[model samples]
Target: MTTTKFLTDEHLSGRVFDGGWTTVASVSDVTEPATGKAIGKVGMTDAAGIAGAAAAARKAQKGWAAAKPDDRAAVFPKAVAAGYEYWDEIVEWIMRESGSVRAKAEFELTLSLKAIQIAGAMPYEAQGLVLPSETGRTSLAKRRPLGVVGVIAPFNFPLYLAMRAVAPALAVGNAVVLKPDPRTTICGGFVIARLFELAGLPAGVLHVLAGRGDAGEALCSDDNIAMIQFTGSTNAGRMVGQNASKHLKKVSLELGGKNSLIILDDADMELALKNAAWGVYLHQGQICMSAGRVLVHKSIIEEFSARLAEKAKALPVGDPMSGTVALGPLINQQQLDHAKSVIEQSVAQGATLLAGGTTDGLFLAPTVLRDVTPAMSAYNEEVFGPVAVLVPFETDDEAVQLANDTEYGLSAAVVSKDVARAIALGERLNCGLLHINDQTVNDDVVNPFGGVGASGNGTSIGGPANWDLFTEWQWMTIKGTPPAYPF
Candidate 1:
C-alpha cells in the first residue's frame, strides 16, 4: 500500500474551508475507535466562522444559479471523479474515524460516488412544469434555487450522508455551508472541499465547517442560510427543526430510528437468517436503519433465535484495518458506553442476553437478546451498536403492532414465503422505506429517502426529492393577448 499524508500527519489535521483551505486555533483530536489513539486532529470553527460561511454561500449562490444548468451539473461529475481518485484515503479515514470494516467502508465510498453521480444527472432530469390556466396566458411554474443551504451531517456514514445533501444542493444550483461531525472532519468535510475544489467548483460555492454541536446550532440559526438539511439523532433533529422554524428557513431532517424486522413463520429460513444478521450487525449496527427490533412469529422464534445467536457469535471483531474483520468498534467511547448501558438495562428488565454482551475497548461484541418485551429499553430505544433484540409475536397483527410501537418510523423489513402477505404487513408498518425479504439497511439514490413522525420533517433527500427541498417554486404567466377589463 502506498503512503498518504492525509491521516498520518498531525499538522495536516482539522483543515477548514470557508473560501479556501486553512486551519483555526481551536482544535480537537480525531481518535481511532478501536484504540483511543489520536490519529488526527481538526480545527474547530466558531459561530462567527459559520456565519461567514453562510454569507459566503449566499454570495456564491446567485452567480451559480444564474449559470446554465448544464454548467452547474458539470461540476458534480468532476467531483465524483476526484472522490474515486482518493478512494483509498477516504476509505482509510472512514475506517479509522467511524470504525467501519473494510466492506462497510467500501459501501460508504460507493454511496458517495452514486450520490455525486445522481446529483450530476439532476440538472437535465429535474425542471419546471407547464400548467393549463385561464384564457390568453401561458402559465408555468419554475424552480429557483434557495440561495445558501446549511447541511449538518452525522458521524456515522459521514462522507456518504453528507454528500447525499451537499451534492444535491450544489447540483440544483444552491451554494452550501456544510458542518460535518467533528469526529469525522478529515474525510467528511476537509476531503469533500478538496474534491470540489479539484473539480473546479468556484470559490465559496461549498464551504466546509468542522465543529461540535455549538457550530451546528449556529448554522441552523444563521440568517444568511436559506435552508437547513440535517441528519442526526431524533433529539438533535428536533432542535435543528425548531431553530430553523424560528428563522422561517426551510429544514430537512433525516433522524434516528428503532427500525424493526419481522420474520413470518413461513419465511425461508436461510433468507431470514441472512437478513437478520445483516439488518442488525452491518457496520457494527451503527446506522439509522439498523434493525434494533426483530419480531418473529412464535412458532419459529426459538429456532430462529438460535441461528441468529450463532451468526452474532461468529462475527469477527477487531481493527477495521484488518481485511478479515467483519465487525469494528463503535464510533467512540460514548457510543460504546451507551450501547453497553442499554444492553445491561434491558437485561435488568428481563430481556435475556442470549449471546455476546461484553466489550473490548470500543469494540462491543455482536450481541443478541431474546424475550425482549416492548417495554424493554433496548426494544424501544435506538441502540446504535451491534445489538439485536428478538421479540416474539403470536400473530401477524401482533407483529405489525410491535413494529409500529416505536416513536421512530424510519425503515422496516418483512420476510415471508407469502409475498402478498408480506406486502400487506409492510404496508401497515410506519416507515419511509420498506423491504420485503430483505434487511432494513437498504437505500437507492433514486428513491425518496426520509422517515415519518420523529424520523424527519419537511422533505426527502435523494434524486428528484432533493430538488423540492433546495428550490422554491414560483409561478409565471406570459400574456399572449390583452387582458379583459372587469367593467
Candidate 2:
C-alpha cells in the first residue's frame, strides 16, 4: 500500500496551543514505526509553553465551570461527529504512528467515540446531595471541578486514553492541559485538539502540548494544575505521582501490568486457546491488560502449550499498512530491544522456547515459552510485546498464587467449564479487572477502568468513578436566620 498525505499542515501546524495553535522553534519529526519514515513534524513545547498552557487553562476554567450542565454536555456529541467525519485519516495516523493494525485502530476509534458519548451525560448526573440539617438550616454536599487537570497519555491507544480523561474532565467543568506521548503527537494530541475545536469548545478549555518528560514535569509541578491523570508505564507513573505529590496535587496513575490468564483442567480447550491467543497477541500485546502469563493446570499444560505454540507460529506478522496481518511492528527500536531482551533472559532462566524468539526488524514473531517459572523475566515483568509465557500449576491454589505473585494488578482472567469455579478463582487474583471465560484485554466505556498496586494508584476512570476522579466534594449550609452564638 502506498502512503499518501493523510496528515497535512493543518494537523501539524503546532504542538502547544490553548485556544489557537502556535508553532514552536524546536520541532521533532514524527516517524512511522513500521517504515521508519518521517511522516510529519510536531512543535516541541518547553517549560515556558507548559506554564503558558497551565495559566490559560486556569483562566478559562471559571467560565467553563459556570456554563450550564446541558451546555457542557452538548460539545461531546459534536466532537464525536467530527471524529467520525475524519475517521479514516485518524485511523491511518494511529496505524502509521503507533504501529497498530487496522482492527486495533478501529477498535480504538470505536472506544474513543463511546467515551465521548458517555462523558456527555456526566454533567447531568447528580452532582450533590441534600442532607438533613440541624437548627432548621439546610445542609448540602456538592461536587466541584478541580480547576485545571493535567492529562499525560501514552503512545499505545493514545486516542482512547486521552479522550477518556479529557472528555470527562471537560464535561465535569474542569479545564485540561493534555501532554500526549511525543511518539504519537499527531493521533493523540493533534486529533483531540481538532475535534474539540470543531465542536466549538470554549477557548483555553483544552490545551495540547506535545513534548517530552520536561514538558510533563512542568505540567505536574505547575501550581495552577490541581490534578494529574497519567496513563503510562509504572516507572513513569511513579515519577509523575511523586512530582504531583510535591506540589500537593491529586494524581491518578494507570500504570503497567503483568496480567495472567488461568486455565483449569476442566476448561474447554477451544475456548481457552482462543482467549489465550487473543489476550497475548492482540495489538502485539502492547496493552496494559495484555496477558503476560498463561497459567495452566498440570493435567492440561502439555496439550495447551503445544496448541498455543502452533497458534503463535501461524500468526502473520508484518507492516499493518502493507497487508492484512495478525500482528504489526513494535512502536520503535527501544520496544523491540526490550522485548528481545525479555525473551532471551527468560530462556536463559530455564524456560523452554516452544515457538518464535525471532524478530524481523521491528516486527517480532508471536512467541511462546513453556515451563516458565516465577523467577523468569517473562513471568515477572511486562514484555509489552506478542510473547506468551506458559506456567503449570497443580491446583487452583497454586494458580491463584502464581497470578497474584506480580506487583501489577491491572487485569486477569480465568477459564473453566464450571462457571462457579472460574468466578471463584478470578476473585482471588489481585487485579482490578477480572474476566471469567474471556480474555484479559476487554473494556467498555461504562466500566470503572483502573487497577491496583503497581498497576494504578487505586483510582478508577469511567462511569461514576469519573465523578470522583475529576471532582472534589464541598459541604454547604443555608439558613434563613442567623443562629444565636456567643463570640
Candidate 3:
C-alpha cells in the first residue's frame, strides 16, 4: 500500500463531512491497475448518499450564486496555486489509480490546471446580451446558473474530465455534486475535493461522491440536481440522458468515439506516422478521441502499415510507476480481454495482424492491424485500447465514406502535405472535431469540445461554451412605468 496526504484515513473510513463528503456504509478497495494490488479503500456512496450530497449542494449553491462573481472567481486562483503546490502528488495519484503513464499523467494534470485557470475568467464573461426591442421597451437576454449540477466523470483522464465541468460550473456560481468512477475515486473525486478545500471554497459547495452506477442514477434522478454533465462510454451516456430526461433535467454528455486518421497519398509519411502512432497509442488509447481507424490512401497504404508496425513493435510497454514507458496497463482485466477479443475477431474477419497481439497481465502491447474492412469489429466498434486498425481507400470519396461510416462523430483527422487539400478533405468528415495535417487526439480549454450523433447530444462544453452549458437563458424587458395595456 502507498501512503498519501490527500486521501487520508478519515476520507477512506466512510465518514461524512459537512464539506459534502457524505458517510458511506461500505467501502470498495482501490487497486493499482498496473500491479493489481490494493492501494487503498474508498467510501462507496449509494443512492441515498447521492441524494444527501445533492441536497447539500443545493443549499450551498444559494450563497455561492449570490456572491459577487469576482469573489467566486477569487477561489480559483488559489485552487490553481494549490494544484501547482501539489503537482507531484496529483500526478502520482493519477498514474497509480488510473494506470496512466507518467507522460499521460502529467498531461492530464496540465490540462486540469489549465481548466481551473480558464474557469476563473468565466465568471467575468458577459452573461447576457442586449437585444433589439419593439414598442420602445428595452429587451435583454440574460443567463442564470442552474441551481446544482451533477458531474459523472469517467476513469480515463479522470481529473481533467471532472475539473473541466466542475470548475466552470462553480466559477459561474452553480454548486457541483461529482460522482467519480469507482475505479478512480481518488484522482477523480477526492483530489478535487482537497484542492477546493485548500482554496477556501465554502462547505457543501462541491461534493465528492465516489460511487457506482446506482449513485450515478440517483444523481440524475435527484430533483435537487438541475443538470447532469457526463463523460463516459456511449451506452452509459444513454442511460444518464434517459434518467435526466425523466426528471426534465439538462444533460451535457461527452461520450464515445471511433475516430479516424485519414492519410492521403500526398501526406508526409513521417509526420503521418507520428500522428497515427501518437493518436492511437497515447494513454493506451483510453482517450475518447483516440484514432481507432487509420484510413490510408491505397497508393501509400503498404508503406504506412509497414512503418506503423515497426513503430508499434519498438514502443515500450510496462508498469508506468516502475519506469518511463511509452504505454501502461489497460485499466483492468476486462479492457485487456476486450482488446484481445477485438484483435482476434478482426483477424478472423480477414484483417491482417501486423505487429502485436500479446499481453502480460493487464499490459497489452501496442497492436496494429492492416487490411481492416467495415465488416470487421475493429472497424465498426470503438476499441478503447492501444490497437490501431489500418484500412485502405482508393479515392477521396471512399476515405470520407470510411471516416463517416461509424456511428461515432466525435473526432477525425486528415494528414497531407497539401494543407489546402487536407482541409478540403477534412471538411467532408462528419465529426464534431476535425483536424488538418494533425492527429485525432487533442483538446484545449478554449475549444468547445463535443461531438454529434452517438458521440454526444450535439452540445459542447468548454470556455465560453460553459456559460451556455451550465446556465439557462431568460429574456427580460423594462418599461418606464407601464406600457398602454390592450383591452
The residue pairs that clash in candidate 1, if any, are 14-42, 14-43
lDDT by residue (191-272, candidate 2, tens digit) is: 8888898899999999988888899999989989999999999999999999999999999999999999999999999899
Candidate 2, position 33, lDDT: 88
Residue 173 in model 2: lDDT: 97
Against the unseen true structure, what C-alpha lDDT does each candidate score? 0.87, 0.91, 0.90
Error of 1 at 396 (Å): 0.5
lDDT of 3 by residue, 1-487 (tens): 2244655677766543448555567888989999988877878888988888899789989999999987899999999898888888889999999999999999999999999999998888888999998877899999999999999999999999999999999998899998888899889888899889989999999988877788888999999999999999999999999999999999999999999899999988899999999999999999999999999999988989999999999999998999989999899899889889999999999999999999999999999999998899999988899999999999989999899998899999998888888888888888999998889998988899999999999989897789889999999999887866897
- Of 1 and 3, the candidate ahead on TM-score is 3
> Which sections of candidate 2 miss by over 4 Å?
1-7
Deviation in angstroms for 160 in model 2? 0.4
**TM-score-based ranking, best first?**
2, 3, 1
Give the C-alpha lDDT of model 1: 0.87
lDDT of 1 by residue, 338-395 (tens): 9999999999999999899999888899999999997888988899999989999999
On the 0 to 100 scale, the lDDT of residue 406 in model 3 is 81
